[model samples]
Target chain A: MSIELEIQLVAVVVSVACSLAGVFLVLRRMALMSDAISHTVLLGIVLVFFITRDIASPFLVLGAAAMGVATVGLVEALVRTRLVREDASIGLVFPALFSIAVILITRYAGSVHLDTDAVLLGEIAFAPFRRLEVGGVDLGPRSLWVMGGVLLLNITFIALLYKELKLSTFDPGLAAALGFAPGLLHYAFMTLVSITAVGAFDAVGSILVVALMITPPATAYLLSDSLPRVLILSAVIAALAALVGFWTAWLVDASIAGCMASAAGVLFLLAFLLAPERGVIAVARRRSRQRWEFARLMLAIHLLHHEGAPDAANESRETHLGEHLRWEPKFARRVVSEAADEDLLVRLQDGRLELTETGRDSARKAMLV
Target chain B: MNPLRDLLFDYTLRTVALGAGTLGIVAGALGTYAVLRRQSLLGDAISHAALPGIVLAFILTGMKSTLVLVLGAALAGWLGTLVVMMIVRHSRLPEDSALGIVLSVFFGAGLVLLTYVQKLPDASQAGLDSFLFGQAATMLERDVVVIAVLGAIALLAVVVFWKEFKILSFDPEFGASLGMPMRSIDILLTTFLVIAIVIGLQTVGVVLMSAMVIAPAAAARQWTNSLSVMVLLSALFGAMAGVTGALISSTAQHVPTGPTIVLCATVLVLISMAFAPERGLIWAAVQRRQQRRQIRADAVLGDLYALAGHHESEHAHDVTVLEAMRAGRTDVHRALDILEERGLARRDGTGGWTITRAGRAEAEQAGESGPDGQHEREGSA
Candidate 1:
């Protein structure tokens, strides 16, 4: 396969993997944690570089995973202490760790190729430059391999622990009573999030990792209720977004990550407007249509009631049933014409619209129905 | 005297200190409500969302005044919040999810604008990039004055609405039942948070400003339970973190101000979490150990009383020390020694342990209570 196709295919796979994990993260209200972990992973990378003096060492991933766990641990500790809320704890820990990473990068500028900009916004275009070779066969990108492994790990972890995760997420108190440790499950989820975030960061950047992790799953949430469906839909959305975003970037000469995020935003907007039952436009349309039908039925009933009045012979043209309806003249005329055709109303010799006997009976039946 | 004078005279140091101090005070004060309302991340989101507004203001106005730029930023921040609220209300998406969406979209737009601004012919745009990660050294005296005035106003508003805010935050349903306008109160709170975020955006940038708001409030919570006290302490903590961050960054050249301030705030949070009274880790551990000791002493005393009664026919008035010791378990021995030392119990002529008047009173009190005595009483009564 050509390198371009291979890169695109790998991007799709990686996006799907991250987004699948993202579904659970977003549902659990851990989207910001993903952002935090992705950014703070730089500290781990930098620290590992400081010790090993090798930026490309595999130990960097390990160091990052450790830091990710530490991030979760610190945040959880702060929150449990009740000194700070969860958001505050997250707000406190990640930036400090990230700043320390930035300081380290600047302090050891000569030894490390990593910089704040690189850490904050990765260059996905450069992924194709680094190749993985197995038995003299050139693999597209080393990030692809790393991300592929992470993806496999995530699927297995999720699959094996699906019931546990579901139980814990939906009802933690019950899970605890049933001999499952909610705290352990929480940490396990965070660990998975941290690893996926780190892997996605290497492939995309911190910002894109956040966007991909949060937006697709969030969008899917708007569209579905079931957890498995949300996960599947989120993955599909992310993969599709990646492909479209990459193409848009190529066509418009914009940043690929930005385009990808924008695409996700578009998808969310679409879902927001079109999703069944809960979509804004759908709800609005349903309400409007229902109101119109109610009005029409009310107009029919009013005409029928007027026709049954005993003083109907003395009524003037201004006192006509159509005039009493007070709808738009054109709409009122249309309603009268339709009713006349249906034998529900009749146009009298005096230019007054009156309901027929059949119309009165049908209108009463409609009201009861 | 010369060193102090020189330190004070340094323009970079003085300006950074002033800027950070003002920013910190404002962020901390506003953050109290943010943390209470569970919208701490809103500050972070708004700060990031402000970037595009700043860039757009610069692009459109072709001016570099901090005032114009900050106003534009406040507008964008409020707009971002509005969008988030709309999404949350209209869709099934949760609040955090909506916030995440707004954060990324606005930040992305800001980045696009920033890149565009960079490519402009104006050299004035050169310093605009610093807003992403703030540089306190770049602040002017005017910036400090603006921040101080805004900070004062924000604090004053918080004070005026202190009761309403407290009621609304802890229990909005109660507030509403009391005929308080919850929506308006909520708007007032959000407006304050937005203004705080906008003002701090210039000094601490997007990401780090969020830390400034949340960290100090978090730290202050560890030390106090009262709302007013928490707000005051949080502001104090914030100012200290800001000043220290500025001072350290200045002393060691090239350190970015935003990250430094964030680092200081994080340190304060850590310190408070580990050491503060009432809720801190150390306090909790100490309380637990103290409770254990008390429970052990109570157990021993109760056992002694039980033993004394068991040997004697009908509620015996006194018992020998050896009889009490022989009847008690092994664990009670050490507790009995401590009780004797404290004069609660005494050793009699026959080596039987006997409860003193004080020990008898204490034993009676302890026997009336258990770990769940209050709960049982509430349930039964």
Candidate 2:
């Protein structure tokens, strides 16, 4: 494969890995924790650099992942103490750790090649240049291998504990009562999140890690209700975003990670406005339809109430219904026409509304519900 | 060698301090509402989203002015806030997810724009980098003036609409019932937050700017329940942290101004969380410890009374027996001392302890009430 293909593949794999765990994070209402962990992992990388002095050491990955887990632990501990608000704990913990990392980098390692921007805005365009060679054997890009491993680990983790995870996430009290150990599962799940965040952070920058983790899964959530479908759909959306982002970056000569995030944002906006069942437009349409249906029923019930009255014709006339029911003349005409078309009520030559059999049945049914 | 005189006379130190201080006061004062309204994460999204605006402004204007960049940042931040609100209103996604999505995606777009700008032959690279990581070393007098003007406008708006903003922050539904235009008030309040965030973005960089807004307000919250005091204290804490951090960064080699200021604000948050009188962790822990001690003491005294009743003639109980009955963590000896001090237990001639009449009465009363140390359900913010 060409270097371009390799770069895009790396983006796709890394985003896919992030979305796998993001499903749970969004479900748990801890989406901000991804932001926190992605940031604090920098502290782990910087601290480990003090010992090894080598930015490329594998230990940095381990240390950073450790810090990600530790961030969750610290946030949970603060929340457990009940002193800090849950959101405050997250907002407080990560910036302190991240600022320390930035400070350490500027103060202690200014001359080194460990650029904070590189960490915050990862250079995925250069991933293809970093080859994974073993002895004299030629291998592909190192990032592809790294991201693939993280993806595989996530798949295995989720597959092995699928039932338990689902049980705990939807109903933790029951899971704990049934001895599934939801609290332990929570930590275990967070460990996966930390590792995935660290891996994605290395590929796409810290903020894009949040974008990839949240936006894809969040978009999928609007389109589906089942867990398995959301997972599958999120990965597919992530892959599509990677392709579009890659093309945008290529055209604009920009950061690929940033472009990918922008792509995800655009896609989410589209989904937010246009999804079939849950999109804003669809929801609005359904609401307006329900309102019209309610209006038609109100007309049917009104006509039925005054069927034999002396003033029935005056009260039930399509034009006079507005004054009696407190609706606009134009709106009452539309409702009257809609009911006539549905055969729930009819407009006579005299301009009065009369409920048909189905109309009377519909009004009585609506009242029962 | 006089620090105060040097702060007044030294141009670099003075500019850095004044610029950061102005940002702190503005962000701190406005962040109180954000935190109170549970929109702290929204502030984070807005700050991150401002990055694209900064870069876009630089791109269009071909020059870097604090005013232009701040305006762009404010516009972008405001747009991001609207996106979050719309997502929450329209979708099943929680508010945090919306916050994360907008912040990361907008920041990503900013980076893309930044990269594009950097590729240009005559791009102002230094100005862009300063906005990214912040360059307190490069702060100017004009920056301080811009921050102060914007901050003053925000503060004036707050004062002008104090009751409306307060009601919007604490109870928008109630405000709506009273015929207040709540949606407009919400937008106006968020506009204040956007201005505050953009004001800080230059000094703390986009990434750490939200801390300036949230930390001071959160810390001030621990000090007071009153809205006026919280806002005042938040602004004061922001300015203090900003100046202290600026000074520290100035004196120290290679210390970036923005992160140090964030660190200073975070320190205030820590101190507030651990030591604030009514809501502090230390006080809560102390109360818990004392309550546990009282319960243990009561249980031990009750154990002694039961033992004394088991035998006739006001029989005395051995320390070993009390220890056995108390089991682990009873600290029977301390309980005995407490009972003795209270004139409830007396040491017998045989080196055993007997429950005195008053002691028997106390133990009976405790036993009748039962050892139900009711754990109250703690409500969180």
Query: Best candidate per DockQ, number?
Result: 2
Clashing pairs in 1: B320-B352, B321-B351, B321-B352, B321-B353, B322-B351, B322-B352
Tens digit of per-residue lDDT, candidate 2, span A1-369: 998999989999998999999999998898999999999999999999999999889998899989998999998897787765788778888888999999999889989977788878998888998899999676899989989999999999999999999988888889999999887899899889988988888889888999999999999999999999999999999999989999999998889999999999899988988999999899999999999989998998888888889989788888777688999988988998899999998777787778899998998887784
DockQ of each: 0.57, 0.73
Interface RMSD of each: 1.7, 1.1
Every candidate's lDDT? 0.78, 0.88
Clashes of 2: 0
For model 2, the stretches where C-alpha displacement exceeds 4 angstroms are: A343-347, A353-369, B1-5, B123-125, B169-173, B289-381
Residue A332 miss distance in model 2 (angstroms): 2.4
- Deviation of model 1 at B148, angstroms: 2.2
